[model samples]
Target: MDMDIQPPRRTFIRQMAASGALLGVAGLSGCTASGVAEEVAPGFRHGVASGDPLADRVILWTRVTPAHDGEGDVAVRWQLATDAAMRQVIAHGSVVTSAQRDYTVKVDAAGLLPGHVYYYQFAVDGGDKSVVGRTKTLARGDAKQVRLAVFSCSNYPAGYFNVYADAARQDNIDAALHIGDYIYEYESTGYACGQAEALGRVSEPRDVLLRLEDYRRRYAQYRADPDLQAVHAAMPFIAVWDDHEFADDTWRDGSVDHKTSQYGPFELRKHAALTAYHEWMPIRVPDASAPDKIYRSFDFGGIVSLHMLDTRLIGRDQQLMLSSYYDEHRRFDVEKYKHDVCSPRRQMMGHEQMAWLEEQVSRSTARWQMLGQQVLMARMEYPTAVVMGECSPTNYCALKKRAEADPSCVNEKEQRWLSAQTLPCYLDSWDGYQADREQVFAMMRKHRKNLVVLAGDTHNAWASDLRDAEGRQAGVEFATASVSSPGMEGGYPGRDPDDVAAMMVDLIEPLYYAQTSKRGYMIVTASHEQVRCDWRFVDTVFQHEFTAATERSLRVLPGPGNRRIEECYG
Candidate 1:
């Protein structure tokens, strides 16, 4: 057995207690007790996970609970086998985990064949074994097809992770792609926690996550969920962090929700958050010194080149709020807003990352170029009236009825409002950084690659045409709904969800499909000829017993002749 050692456990425990984390652990049911009782013993309670798979290697991860308070580093043994029964052991190793890494064990199990399935598990030196986990390696050369399960925005207190459970049962999926927001940073009574008390899904710590221990405990709570664990155990995950992983609307310097007076320093909080994220997630860090540089590419056996990007924290400028452009009279200055938004100095993916992406896209020889990213990249422009809250669905319907009844009854202001000029609804998306978006479009057009953008921050399902500023179609975008977060229906209190969705599609030109109220995920299938995306939704996340159904299916063909999205028919 191989043993890896760290600093003294007593010193680490004292530091953790000083941070108030040790005191809060007792109230959190998700956290396992350190003291060994008669009924319970120290074991692998958080389950196993695998991620960031390459052609020859995959990351295996698990956590070991301490049997007693004074325990030092724990030695864990892991095995990788070709079969589930562990008869054909191909790789085995031992590693030591201590409080320094939150007792989480992560090993890069290499020496595996390309596109092969492997089962892995971990056990303490003399303890019981953990549940078996299955993972697959990326294909190296030619491949017929590739399928990926796309997910985002999984808030623990909002509801159960039924979307993950449903995706776990999918046998054909090669890997799982989590675009962002794998965990929320809110307290027990924050965003989308109205039903948390009734569902008994209160967040651990019961306070907002600001320290390293707080973030680690939150991840532990999420990993403890059977549904989340099942999905992680079923397939290797390729993930990136969004704003919620740190704080709401996090940028480079700070977050919108963070106050330096209360949190001490934003940098300290961010470092703590990143440290916990690295320790908890099964990701291969790009750079040990610079952890924020997470943008990288993965080639899927020449079929698809998946480029996972970091758009939130890397090179993003402070988001431009549309409300800031309003006057004292509550009138919006469309021209001034447009001029400021189109400034060429603004950036979304920063200079270094953008240059890297351009080089990668230009040189890739794969059949499909898929961008796995966070915000909506397509044009989601809505009418000015609709965006400014001047016109709701109910109001629009009533005005239409009145206009049909008597043409003269409708006034000029109403007509102008109805035909209001269109603008981007959320400035935090690519819409705010128009110059950067144009640069990307120019690169795609120059390369003439088969582009497919996968986005998932809105918590609502969307399918849109990727077009340039001049209205030339570049590709297509498939934005998945959140795994558990509420959608647009939550904003519009009384309007029907279907009506809101229909209204959005009618107003937004590039939008082809929309599901305003549903908790679901997307299954993207890529081939040489075409790429298809199926939006699958669960009936309810309030209960464990739920049924899933395909809400919509859309496909985009390769080449210039078919850059637009069309209904996928049998």
Candidate 2:
């Protein structure tokens, strides 16, 4: 396979525009009849978006670029209507945006009817208008059904955002749920940039993001993506940030990717990232004083209570690394590693967030308790050798065959390797914080809630049965795949993705389904009876032309004792 070949930027953009993607700035520009360059007008070039919806309101956002640099603050007007033509306006407002806000405007339009759709648009004093945006308010009394389009790990330079585009065209989707990794902070040459240059998808600024302006520029670049703009324009988004939004493997105070010696201080970087995030995303700040506190709950009538959590930034302790448990002889101390990982002092969500979650869950009378979080909360334990990548799928199959053929043929060392104790593969997930996970399970069990967890960040689709340390069923988790980032297939070169996925399911007891190599999203539907998740995959992200299909569907029924995933029938 030729890895370097990719479609040209102009051709890609043209095809995307034809296929319903928003036109790139270059595509939107043109010359006059006399051949003189025509100046682009000042308007809402970044497109309009709405998010963080409530029963009575939704946040609307847009960015107005001045015709020239150094222009003073720009006055913008906004209107919300029940019709697309903006003739029957229900709410209208005006705001002033300056360079301090990066020329971005956000408005929380209130006085909306519950479970209703509204059309919104922004304009300048001279009558320049933005693309009309569509958003829906949450249901207030009785929502028999609510559907959400879930997405994550959208690396702009990796490939086209066909997943977002496909979801934009779908019907009956109440809103979009961006669990995390909304914008990656890597440089153009970092991570999954193998074909970025060929596809004309290079990251702007050409460097790793650090300061306020750097983060803002990255957000601008991503929002300018036609597919991304189309999705934001089509539906409201409920978002929370994962590690890549700030830095990879981010904790409360620092990250593995950050170097204080070079980047100065992690605190300043975090502040800048958060500032840019708040400015660009249409999210309602949970607290005006503490911008970092973004963990909040949303109720859909009496059917579901969706709790979006902040597992990366606010209260997470440093993640545990297995390499740190190596002894003098280069032997791993598994017992010690387990003990440290099970320590009660280790926190994933701090005391304050946990208390708040308990209160929300306890007070809600909804039929379903859905946690829209960033990381997996299920037990994904594999054999130590497999977790450490010492045993490939092919190798494991061969060993199993030999062991079944003759017991005496396998040596003691091989037996130990084959029957190795199981452990979590990624310490960055909830598996690393067993004590904290158990605390959450205890709270859910106490409230007798029918838990359905929606998670992303693995860049792979997964369905797992969540279990507590006591081996009791806790809930079911549906983890969506990445929008473009590579999955487990990237880690194992030349291996079949299907084989890898099968091996994972065979080794991990809690994992019911897994797709290791795919770029896609999931649609989670909640009702009074059950919650169903359908994983949808795009055929290709390397090109604008593509097809989307439902790869898998599973559901969990509302129960007093049972809370496990089962195949969705009919």
Candidate 3:
């Protein structure tokens, strides 16, 4: 467990109580998402938002709960301010939000100063306003410096998002490139979270999400997190989606989480997920990358070109399962060959996306070209050597997972009795899709050399020096770590996550520096010379007050072969 203590909803209520007293406002806990909870409408219910910044202007988004309550439209006035408070207004206007878009409103505030910070908020009923949101316009493409906070795979019920909270505190970051999985499809405690599921933090619907309402409830719950809210309030975010935002390891047609008719048809489920994802997230409509078109690009002062790729929708091949592994002992018959590494035309990013990615890489003139996308571009291999007596993430974590097999009778409450551990490899990630990995590496080599890959599907931190098609280190570097909704490798019961990660890294020989069973985020800094990355981990996430530190520091020098591990533990 990330923390022995579960999320303290009562603590939040208490904090609200104190803050409410300070502001002479009432703590409104009884309000529903459909209607206003209190007579007082103080600023942002969802908090401030800023995005899609050009040199002069940026996109602004907000929602207003109505007095006709959930059903009626609320005409809200928005104002951009130079000060943190709304005393000085730069641009002011009015927009109406109705039930059509779930009372959400988005407006692009253009014609502002370049490379400058601006504060904006919304006033509902032309009176009460939202929390001030701070945003910055980009410098010209040729500008000298820019930093990015890259992340993905954040499942709210998984744990406290100290990663997002920490990234919010980072220095000099221009924007955040969230490469998907902002929301997950699981409705209950679908995965092993760091805390007890009994916490109201349990994802709503109490099962796998299928209906639009289920998806919406999930988003509202995630957005209710104060840390995630603070990060969004603090900076402009650019995002794309990965599978869990729809379903675990999803593709155009289905997902790993998909079942038969009870969840509805796969297409309908996908449609519902995408519809809700588009509506709730601070993303633009008619995203070009659809089937669930969340992929897009962002240029940072033109010095660094961020090419966001959509790896899931158009070209995703079906995920590999345990069936892909057959015993080499020839002890089993033909049915044993089911999991025989299905490389038969499987893809992580389909052909069209591959071509699009290649074009973007080739066209970039920036000093650093970052492939900001979901999933790792590297082909991680399985650990052929399994220590006979040990099991990791534990059979307990994996056992409880309906993923490979059903939960055994092992009681997690009896965790103290276990001794030693074993490690089995996950068949997801790049390790599951070898052919797709080869194609992407080929593109990186052919189109560009100064490339760095950022990923967040797996939860533990990794630093890999990617090799070219010829097995020569391609000067391309991959920095991927664990999830917002973490997958295995977090170690459980008898396994110390660090020791288990140690055995796996040794067997697979991935170019990883530090892997922790901890929670936190990555911070990236790019100059013309080098791109520096820090894997920051929090001491504990479920606790409100936790210390964060650098678990590892790595660097990819510009024009590279492999990223050099620099000041690893510093």
Residue 407, candidate 3: alpha-carbon lDDT: 33
Model 2: lDDT of residue 426: 83
Question: What shift in Å separates residue 350 of candidate 1 from its native position after superposition?
Answer: 0.8
Query: Model 2 — which ten-residue stretch has the worst lDDT?
Result: 1-10
lDDT minimum window of 10 residues, candidate 1: 1-10
Quantify how close model 2 is to the true structure by its C-alpha RMSD in Å. 5.0
TM-score: which candidate is best? Answer: 2
Question: Which scores higher on lDDT, 1 or 2?
Answer: 2
For model 1, how big is the CA root-mean-square deviation? 8.7
Clashing pairs in 1: none
> Which should have the higher lDDT, number 2 or number 3?
2
lDDT of each: 0.85, 0.87, 0.64
Off by over 4 Å in 2: 1-39, 388-390, 397-411
Candidate 1's C-alpha runs over 4 A off are: 1-40, 393-411, 418-420
Model 1, span 1-570: residue lDDT tens: 111122122332234335432222232343442212223455766778899999999999988766664468988999999876667999999999998888889999998999999888888866667777889999987678999999999998899998987887775688999999999999888999999989878888789999998998888888777678777878899999999999998887888999999988989988998998888889999888999888989899998999999999989998988889989999888898988778899999999999999999999999888999999999888777777887875677667668879979989988987666778858888999899988988898999888899999999999999999899998999999999999898788897888889877777789999998999999999988889999989888999878788778899999889878998878
Candidate 2 residue 5 Cα shift, in angstroms, is 24
Q: For candidate 1, what is the TM-score? A: 0.91
Highest lDDT scorer = 2
Each model's TM-score?
0.91, 0.93, 0.81
**Residue 383 displacement (Å), model 3:** 3.8
